[model samples]
Target: MKSFITGASGYLGQRLAIKLAENGEKVHALIRNPKAVKTLEHPNIKFFFGDVLDNISIKTAMEGCETVFHVAALARVWTKNSDDFYKINVGGTSNVIRISQELNVSKFILTSSTGTIGPSLNLPNNEETPRWSSFNNDYEISKSLADTELLKHAANGFPGLIVMPSRIFGPGIASPSSGVNRIIIGFIKKGFAVIPKQSGVIGNYGFIEDIINGHILARDKGAIGEKYILGGENKTLGELFEAIKNRVNKNGLVLKIPVWPLSYYSLFSQFLADRFGIEPRITPDLVKRLGQNSAFDCSKAISQLGYRITPFEETIETTIRFLSQSEDR
Candidate 1:
């Protein structure tokens, strides 16, 4: 099998590509940066430089591939320009769908997010749960729009499957650079002494390997136009931090600050970060999102795709070990 993966240099995409290669599939990765090409160098993997916005680029990279994994997106909480977010997340997704249909690719897998579903009030969120209008940030909005568009295309006879992963917590093949990774690193470095009070939100955490396995199973058994939630066990922020603290054998101070004050602080921090052209350590949107529960249920994926997730504690230990080794090096 020949597989094409967008965002191949990303945490999830890179791991998925390597796993596919290990499974005896030829992998072609679409990368935007020349420097990223070196990261994907493997015997069964080839890199193609392209942007998802350019149809020609996507088409060229997708040529002769039986499966296409659309994993690229503008994942950010605070962006001054919503246009960039929409252009990359929604518009880019549309292009991928169109090209996959035009190329007659047998399977097109979308690496969507549980953010599209938002917080569940009465019950655990399933794929059939109705999306809430209160999606916090531009990133979530764009992903929701993209997921809606993909569903529309699927209804029109496009062969597509969506895999919605919760908070991904396992170590990546490359270095850690995402929000989750930052939290882990901060805790390890004793930077996260104060635990915010408004963090009652239960985030579902999944290991990257389990998520990739879920994607592969979805490709093999998922019905066209169907969506699956490949979520792991859900836990609160405090519980998560405690787990990490136990694993690292350290006791970090925990303070519970109200959401309103933190939100204001996040806004100021974001403003400063934007002025300096740096990503903020915290954003207002993120602060607000942390106050809402983001739990999900993956029973459908479990029954249909045979999806199994590692325990959250186990994933945390593995991530800390990987980070410790990298730090030692």
Candidate 2:
């Protein structure tokens, strides 16, 4: 079997590539930068330099691959250029689907985010939940569009299965620099002591390994044209911070701020970040998102895909351990 993965150099993609290779499958990793090629080198793995926005690159990378895992996307809380988010998240996904269809891949697994499912304040969200009118951020909106595009293509006879994962936390293949890595770093450095006032908002979390496992399972047993929520435990931000504090043996205060005040602060932060072309530490979208309950239910995946997740405490321990080792290095 052959597997072609976009964003194979990313945290989840790299792990998936390794797992596929270890299971005796040939893996082709699509990366845009020539410098990133070395990181994906292995006996059973090949690297292809390609941009998802470029059809030629995508088409070339899809040739002879039996399974395609479209994992690459613009994932960020705040960005100066919102157009870049759409280009990479929406346009990139379209290209991947088109190329997969052209090559007749046996299965196409899309790495969608649970962000699109919106806040589950009243109840746990299932795959049947409709997209919320209020998107948390541009990243969420772009992903929702891409997910819709992928599903549309699937309806048109493309073998697509969407795996919607919640906020993933774990060690990275290359380095722990972004995504949950940032949070882990912050926790280790005592940067998140005070729980923002939106602490009551529910957050769904899954370990990277568990999320990758869910993706593989979705590829194998998922029904074509269906979406599966690959989520795990739901806990409040305050609980999460407490877990981190316990793991690090640090005492920190969690100050709760009202939503309105946080929103204004986030807006100011975003303005400053955009003016300087730097990533915002906080954004209005993020503030709004953090104020909502983002819980999700993965019963379908649990039963159909045999998906199981580690306990939240265990996940936190593993993450902290990985971060500690990385810091030592």
Candidate 3:
């Protein structure tokens, strides 16, 4: 009847909160900034100013809610202090789980990432896929740790499940975690882009609407302690760009660079960041991650949760239109 959501101001969380509210559920949305309430205003949605790290605030907001969606995380490619990743992703997640258990929440969905599944080894990764390599960055490592914590709690009789969504795109807040949407914006607005030389590196791209629906289905039908990969088409970087070009009817200059050279460039970017506090466009760890295959298999979610993926071409066109409209405003 009621739900509590963390990171309600974020791209996915914001959309998820609104979706639940529209579905006639009383939604308590946790956001650190009070100003974000403007965007989330709905008759069924109430704003709770809080952070996931604070037990008192989480407990207060989650009171009387039947479900909790832990959607908050530090998903950036680089942070000045790497500890920030573990602190929020792992620590914040643990706090929420403890509070949820204390409050007797019926369903808990932890929003994990497909990155934790690691790059594809011999095939596209499935829910059972183990990390084939050490984590490429702190974000992945921290999220993986958070997933472990959720599962541990679930095994101990906590009502929790993990939903891992691959690089989500389409209309939503262009947060750092929404990299695919940012890429679409860049190609359409700037008319120029740079990519890894090996453009064939495969990755899974999911539409935002599909991902949101997957979360709802996970809550309704997902098994306790199980992790589901909610994803769409397995596409190469080249194919991704080609789809955008076709949809927009415009050509963008996409220059591909070798990974080694990009690594050197990222080193310089990091140096600039360390010296002047400017955010690096890319980092060495991100480059390494991108060079590997990030594709996934969503058959489990498809079969168990009735998850459906939109056709990639239609999804891209819809995304391009949304981005184009936003730029005009």
lDDT (CA) per prediction: 0.84, 0.82, 0.91
Candidate 3 C-alpha lDDT tens digits along 87-203? 999999999999898889999999999989898976899999777698888898899999999999899999999999999998987689888888878877778778888999998
Q: Mark the regions of model 2 whose C-alpha exceeds 4 Å error after superposition.
A: 173-179, 252-261
* TM-score per candidate, chains pooled: 0.94, 0.93, 0.97
* Candidate 1 least-lDDT 10 residues: 173-182
**Where is model 2 poorest over a 10-residue stretch in terms of lDDT?**
172-181
Candidate number with greatest TM-score: 3
Better of 1 and 3 by lDDT: 3
- What's the residue-level lDDT of 10 in candidate 2? 77
lDDT of 3: 0.91
List of clashing residue pairs for candidate 1: none
Q: State the lDDT of candidate 2 residue by residue for 1-329, as single tens digits.
A: 89999988777788888888888889988887787666666799988887799898787878899999999987777667889999999999988888888788999999998888888858888999886557767888899899889888888888998999888888766443245567667667764554577577788888888888898899889999998988779888888877877777566444565678767877788778878886766777766667688889989999998999889888888888988888778
Q: List candidate 1 segments past 4 Å from native.
A: 173-177, 273-278
RMSD of each: 1.9, 2.1, 1.2
TM-score of 1: 0.94
